[model samples]
Target: MSKYVIGDIHGGFKALLQVLKKVAIENEDQLIFLGDYVDGWSESPQVIDFLIDLNKKYNCIFLRGNHDALLCDYLKNGNYTEEWFIHGGKSTLDAYKTLDSVTITQHIQFLENLKDYHLDNFNRLFIHAGFTNIKGIEFEYFKPLFYWDRTLWELALAFDNNLKVSDNNYPNRLKLYNEIYIGHTPVTRINKTIPVNKACIWNLDTGAAFSGPLTIMNIDTKEFWQSDPLPQLYPNENGRN
Candidate 1:
């Protein structure tokens, strides 16, 4: 059985389905999603519904994202900020307009139950964003950092490639895992539309919320698949651009 990690979907249900079709996933395969399943596109609520159903039939691990957290808070308390609304939240709100209260509550439960981070048997770490404890994720005092921090990725990007884990100056956080898989910061920002490896950190968010395609990668083989850009999938919408 293979283990696949998906990047930020950003409410592109069509893009998510397209990539999954490319993967031709099997029942034995594990699907680990890096969250941001909602927001950006016009089908945010549908994306959540699909994920809820998908998990019942497949091995799926859904992690919490900053957007997901914000959405959850909005759903639970009906509170929203101008920043949240502009950052794809408005689209998500529009998508949920047709859903009944029962379905909305179910979606809220799904969002509330999402994991902050997942550590696998092989010492691979999967998180929506990054964590900051110098010791490790478990030692992280601020739980929100698991899905809100960017310093870890920033550190990886700036790290000297020559620095080994055994080196005295190596970042302690990078040494905590054999590999770190994250999706909050899209690689498209660096002009890359594919999964990027820097040090031991791998960024899988290929900017589905913007101009790039949705992506999925096999953790073991590093084999990946991508769908057409979100704009191409939803011809009329601007997504989060």
Candidate 2:
């Protein structure tokens, strides 16, 4: 069975559907969803519902994202900062208004249970963001880095193309895993709307929360599929753009 790594969804349910259909996923396939599942477009609640149902039908690994953590905090404590509200949280809160208490509770539970990262048998690491510890994830002092750090991505981006893995100067973090797949920071920031490879890290977030499409890639083949841009699919609503 094939294993596919999905990018950040960010409430683009229509875009999410489009990419999944384009991928033609099978029941036997394993789907690893890097987070930011909610907080962008108008369908944050719907996205969570669909993911919950989808998990029942397939093998799925869900990673926590910074936005997801913020949403979880608000859901549990009814506390939200202005930063969270302005950064797509308003749309997410609005989406949840129609849900009943039971549904809200279920959504909270789902969000709380999301994994910070997933390490595959092949030593490929899937995380929402990045870890800073030179030794690796297990030794990371700050757990939130799994869903919030940008340094790892920046380091990868700044890596010298001429450097070999065997070089002593190669970043220690890049050598921790065979491959590291992450979301959280959109590749669109670098002017591309496709998954990008830097060093041994694969950044799958193609800016689904903004103008770029949601993406899904086969971990083994590097083959990928994308939806139409979120702005096109959700023209009526300005998603986190």
Candidate 3:
């Protein structure tokens, strides 16, 4: 069975469907989604519904993204921040308007149950975002970093560029896993439209929340597939901008 890791979807349901079809995932395959499944495009509810159904048919691991957490917070506490609304949360709220209470509750339950990170038997670590202080598989008490940290990716890039070095010859976090896969920070910020690999960390979020395509990678083979650029999929929208 093959193992696949998908980047942040960010409510691009059409893009998500295209990438899944491109991959042609089998029942035996393990699909790991790095989260940000909602809050960018016009179909946040549809994306969540499809994912719930997908979990019933496939071995899927869903990680919780910062956006997903913001959704949860809004659902449970009626707390809506301007920052959250600006960052595609408005679209998500609009999507839920047509759904009934039962469906919305189910979606909330699904989001609430998502894992923060996943560790495979192959020593690969899958997380929505990178961690800071980690001891083996255990991260520090700062839970928000699980879905909002950018410094970890910066450190990886710094190390890759030889800007940072250690006497032990490897970053402490990199030593814990054979490889680490993450999403959350789009690769486009670094001026790339594809996955970026620095040190032992592979960033899979190809900026589908904005202008790039969603990416899926075969973990073992390192083969990958990407959807058409998101702007092309939904030309009328500016996607979180």
Candidate 4:
């Protein structure tokens, strides 16, 4: 069975569908979605619905992203923040506007139940973002960093760029896994339109929340597929910008 890891979809339901169609996943194949399933586009509810349906047919692992956490927090406690609403949350809110209370509650449960990270038998780690302050694969506080930290990606990029002179000496957090797959930091931020590999960390978020395409990668072969750019798919939307 093939193992696949998909990047942040950010409510781009159509793009997600296109990428899935391109991959042509089978029943035996497993899919690991790297979170940020809601926000950005106009179909956040539909995205969650699709994922729920997908879980019925295949083995699916969904990680919680910062956006997802914010949404869940709002759903649970009605804690609304301006920052959350501005940064793609508005789109997500708009998407959920038509759903009934029961459906919204169910979606909240789905988001709340998402895992923060997943580790496989192959020594590959899948996380929505990255984790710092961990001891031997166990986190020592700083749990929110798993879905909110940018420093880990910065470190990986620094090492990749040869900016750090000591290549062999990595921080303890980076050493925990043989290969780490992350999605919070979009590769497009580095002017890359494709998945980026640096210091054994693979960044799968190709910025579907912005202008880039949604990406899906084969864990074993390192082969990948991408959807059309977000701007191309949804012509009028600014998409979390």
Q: Name the regions of candidate 1 deviating beyond 4 angstroms.
A: none
Task: Write candidate 4's Cα lDDT for 1-241 as tens digits.
Answer: 9999999999899999999999878999999999999889988889999999999999999999999998888777888789889999998877777889998898988998999899999889999888767473375487888899888888888764443434565566666788999999899898998999998799999999999999999999999999999989999898987
Tens digit of lDDT per residue, candidate 3, span 1-241? 9999999998999998999999878998999999899999998888889999999999999999999999988877788999889999999988877889899899889989999899889889999998888585474678778899888888887885553445555677776788999999998998998889988899999999999999999999899999999999999998986
Backbone clashes, each candidate:
0, 0, 0, 0
Candidate 3 or 1, higher lDDT:
1
Candidate 4 accuracy as TM-score: 0.94
lDDT of every predicted structure (CA atoms): 0.94, 0.94, 0.89, 0.88
- Give the Cα-based TM-score of candidate 3 against the true structure: 0.95
TM-score of each: 0.98, 0.98, 0.95, 0.94
For model 1 the local lDDT of residue 37 reads 92
User: What is the TM-score (0 to 1) of candidate 2?
Assistant: 0.98
Better of 3 and 4 by lDDT: 3
Q: Put down candidate 1 lDDT per residue, 13-94, tens digits, no spaces.
A: 9999999999878998999999899889999988898999999989999999999999999999998899989999999988
lDDT of 1 at 126: 97
Q: Rank the candidates by lDDT, best first.
A: 2, 1, 3, 4
- Candidate 2 lDDT, 111-207, residue by residue in tens: 9999999999999999999999999999999999999999999999999989887998988998889999999999999999999999899999999
